[model samples]
Target chain A: MDKSLQKTEQEEIESKRKVYREAKEQTRKNARRLRFDESNPQPKKDSVDSPRKRFYRQRAHSNPFSDHRLDYPKSPESMDWSKYYPQYHDKESNNMLQDVEIADIGCGYGGLLINLSKEFPKTLCLGMEIRVQVTQYVEDRIIALREQNKSKDINYQNIAVIRGNAMKFLPNFFKKSQLSKMFFCFPDPHFKQRKHKARIITNTLLSEYAYALKVGGIIYTITDVEDLHNWMVEHLTEHPLFERLDKQWEDQDKCVEIMYNSTEEGQKVERNKGDKFIACFRRLPDPEI
Target chain B: MKHPYQNIVSTSTHLFVSVQNHLQAFDVEGNLVGSWKDTIGHEDLLKKQQLEKIEKLNQEPEIKRAENNKKVKIPKIPTPGPGAPTIYNYIRDLELTHDNKYLIGITDSDKSIIIFEINLNEDNCLKLIKRQTFPKRPCSISIADDNSTVIIGDKFGDVYKIPIIGENVPEKDLKPILGHVSLLTDVLITEHNGKQYILSSDRDEHIKVSNYPITYVVKHWLFGHDEFISSMVQFDFDRELLVTGGGDDYIYLWNWYGNKLLSKYPLRDLIEPLLDESHLPPERFLHEDSPKEISVVKMITMDKFVVVLFQKVNGLLVLEIKDETLHLVELFPLDYPLIDISAGGDKIFGLSEDKIITQFTFNGKLTIDDKEFKGMIENNPCEVQSKEEFYPLYTMNTLRKRSEH
Candidate 1:
């Protein structure tokens, strides 16, 4: 072989090896980004890219009865909303400029929060998820969106996610009549009769929800399980503090439409050709004794 | 093989002590006046309830599938085997009506509230009038101020109201007026400004105040605790003040009607020195280095002093209320840990381990006067297999919610 041809072959091999090494390094970086470091949760400088859903996958069900270690404020006055909404913090008063008015319980993958962030740009929205990894995924997703839109309008700073057991302590995080809207999109069915108490919607838990919600506030619920839908309807209707909203009301409501299509669970149900049942209830004023 | 008194209650003429399934009444002179033991009828009732539960459990899957109109495979209900026979049925939560005309006690064997007519003059001082079984074990009960109604709080977090003199309502037809998702620890009926209120506390550290009969109207939640609440007491000197204690290291003083925390009296500093190896977390925790925890077992208000008992600790902590704050007055230690405490008039009776009763009175100082009732309850016949059999006496610690997945 000629010396020039041998030199060209050597150069080609060197370039191919360099490409392999760079690809390996990129894979390593992605893996690190996916791993959640609970102690050091700050996002990396280059985390502007969207997180891969497959990397943040977790079990869909969590037992509400179990003693899950959760961090929550003792009362609404003690909750430091500034940590969640840093942009809304007022330095002189040492508090957030506005309270979170909308809450998405069991916000799986946070699709609804992302959509609501743009729809209600002025309102602060919070997503509470019980599962740890899923909550971290949503936190990362929001951080990346905010970083991507750093200089643009609607920077995704209005939406945040927190790990919590919403069933145990709703009043601890929100003051009496603090919330304007609450969404329960595609909650766990808990089909067994013995496990019915563990369901999100019960006559007892409704009182807590009513306490946290304003008199005119709305509770939006949607599920693919017909039984669960009726269960929610029956319980909400039975509660004196809540009244079922008419279908016509649901048809005109903005949150109802967003809830039906924006959640990851809702989208999955849609793809499977499942029937989706929706119910809306308005919190009623307390009766004078 | 002596069994400690599981519960104690007092009236002007008689002192009632329950040892396992046997209840004995003693006069002021330490003479046994009347005695009654739980009959075989209670066992029969328990068996019937167990069978009914199994039947219900077996039918549930079919009912759920039909209601859903979906083909879903539900897990099969396991049939429990006849494993062993144990004498765990004991009398708990003994109380007397305001008029002292009736005695109420909860029997665990059948999960029934037994109401007996009290007549100290008759040869049979106690006469069983009604035995009402509940869907779940009744953990705590309170009588209405008018004495017309009895409020029962069960282990499943349901509070049911039944007329004190009415017929037994079938369990299936009974409805809970109010409930919590967590296990109920205590329930109390109190009145302020002529309006009655139902105060209920649960293992989730929630103290809910609701309007009686209109239990749907939740007035507010007293929300300062971070651990399970085991005991609660209302001050007689000031009806507005409420004292509560539990798994936390502190007891709280609150104006429950106003939903305000007046003070938190720290107990960890006093309890930490009394902890032993038995105070370690359950064996399932895997973590060997976790610190010991305290569980407040019982509390009673006596005049201006609030007396508290902790699980597995051989002592009573007396705190005095002054200037809207609780100050530790005395750490009254005993030879054995007290399993239960009750107050009548100005006297406090603490039933300790191995069938011991220690009487106490406060006249600017904590004084013990066990001479009258010491030998009276020692001869009462209730059996215990070993020291380990007293584990139930310290079960308040089990209410502490573990962080395991």
Candidate 2:
């Protein structure tokens, strides 16, 4: 029995190495294709379209303009989360409650999600992004990470990335009290007075966030702009369902450490020696009327 | 440059400036007269009380043991963000009544449309006459000819006609008069050939003219703009002529009565030189070599010229319409992108998003003393002197006109 177990372990290690090699080979081919495309540009119609144009076109066609069905799912249960995180698809256990419990809004390039996945391996996490190519790159990165770490039993099956406007489809993706943690890192500070309503954190949007978050859920926000940082702090501090967590608690939190250093934007800011302002708020229980 | 007001509406002598949470009226000479701030509504008071209660409960550890009920509706308390005071509660649309006795505005905070009676005799005292909440947030509002009725167009593409004289009506009592099935950008009530019609534009590049009061009957659908139509205006002299500016890099002229496209003014070259790449997002798609599109925010038309404000372009395009030809007048470059502009009695005011109000003459002359405007108290009353100098950052070349093939 001992000899048989040892043989099986050796086979598993060999298969894992093969998967890693195959993933590396696929990445190398993707790089080569990108180079070829650069040398001789493709004639695809979408190749000429910039990301801003694509973003505007997508917004004009979604939700209030066209059918909300395209951007929003009626219920979170209807969405197949397993397709995004295939390694987590357990065939032996027929459980329906297993789902993404953490979300990163506007997770550009998804550096935080990748880091947090390793810290909380059992918990499912999702990165929601609006840009198409950025989301695709993140998806590919996760696939590669999963293959490379298959042998170590610390694979990136807990994380996934999806391309969608988080502002419009947040409730569609998350059920009530479905999320334990939500993160907003390095959001675009609209700066313009008229465009403040387009901000991710508002009194109206906070209600939606509170509805999706568990009673004890935590909201983490970090930004480089002092004005935007103060704006987020004031809004979150005044929200009835949220209470600002103690600074000491945030300093000790492992997630906060990763949030400060893990994201692509965070690293860039670090290199520039830019000051990062972080604020965390815990969702209070519903008020007893 | 600072834009003290986000939206400015003008009569002949009175300029109703939308400041923070209230509407402040200024004379043609730029002296502060009356101010109007809407009182907290009943629902808003309840929301505030609930917030205070929650704060108390969260502070005391022993009282937190009480079981909380999830079914109770908790109202959202809008917190004033850290920036300019009252940043969250901005006037989405403000208009002066036909008689100039009342100033009406739509505030996005409580989704309330408030009417303030401006009594110039009593030191410009403004009394809140009525405040009504809408089912959806209103983007643009137009007071009717009689001033008793107002036509409001919402972001959801629904237009509703509510009586300004009536008692407060609940949300269920109010219904949309007409809808476009797409996000409505601007709405106008105009009389053409002795008949009233509702001229509306949307994000889907559609401009529809329908008979007012009986708006279900569509009269004309002008389809030329390929993107979001941000602003539209009817010529003061000839209502037949309509001008529209949008996400597309052109200003369109239309003869609405005949439903014909008269001329298209290409704005790409005029605005290309003013485009600052630093203002754009740092996303991968916004990298160098990508074509950028400039959008028009608002268009203000005077008798001889029309001033068009482009989004993110800190400059105003002064265009002259002579006979059937549209000629470029001059480009006055500003330090900041203005939010709203109002013109009356040979004076024009440009309101910036940074709370700087830059006043100009009808001939594109910067009127404010630069030192005082940048250093003094922003909200205090100050005399605005028009400098005889007309500084042109760039000379106006001939307009590059385009036509549909």
**Which predicted model would earn the best TM-score?**
1
- Write the residue-wise lDDT of candidate 1 on A56-100 in tens digits: 567889987677888888878889887677788887888689999
Report the C-alpha lDDT of model 1 over B1-405, residue by residue, as the tens digit: 687777888864677889878888877566787778887445576467567666665667887868888664443444446885444677878988888888898988788898888888888788888889887889998899888888999988889888879799998888788888778999999988888899999998889898877787778889889899988898877888999999998999999888899999998888888888788888887376777888898888878888898888877899999999999898887767888888766667778774467777666566787565645656578766887776376687669888766
Candidate 2 global TM-score:
0.51
Task: Note the clash tally of each candidate.
Answer: 0, 6
| Model 2: how far residue A280 lies from native, Å | 56
TM-score for chain A, prediction 2: 0.75
* DockQ of model 2, rounded to 2 decimals: 0.03
Candidate 1 matches the true fold with a TM-score of 0.87
Alpha carbon deviation, residue B82, candidate 1 (Å): 12
TM-score of each: 0.87, 0.51
Q: For model 2, what is the alpha-carbon lDDT of residue B190? A: 87
Candidate 1 chain A has its poorest 10 consecutive residues by lDDT at: A29-38
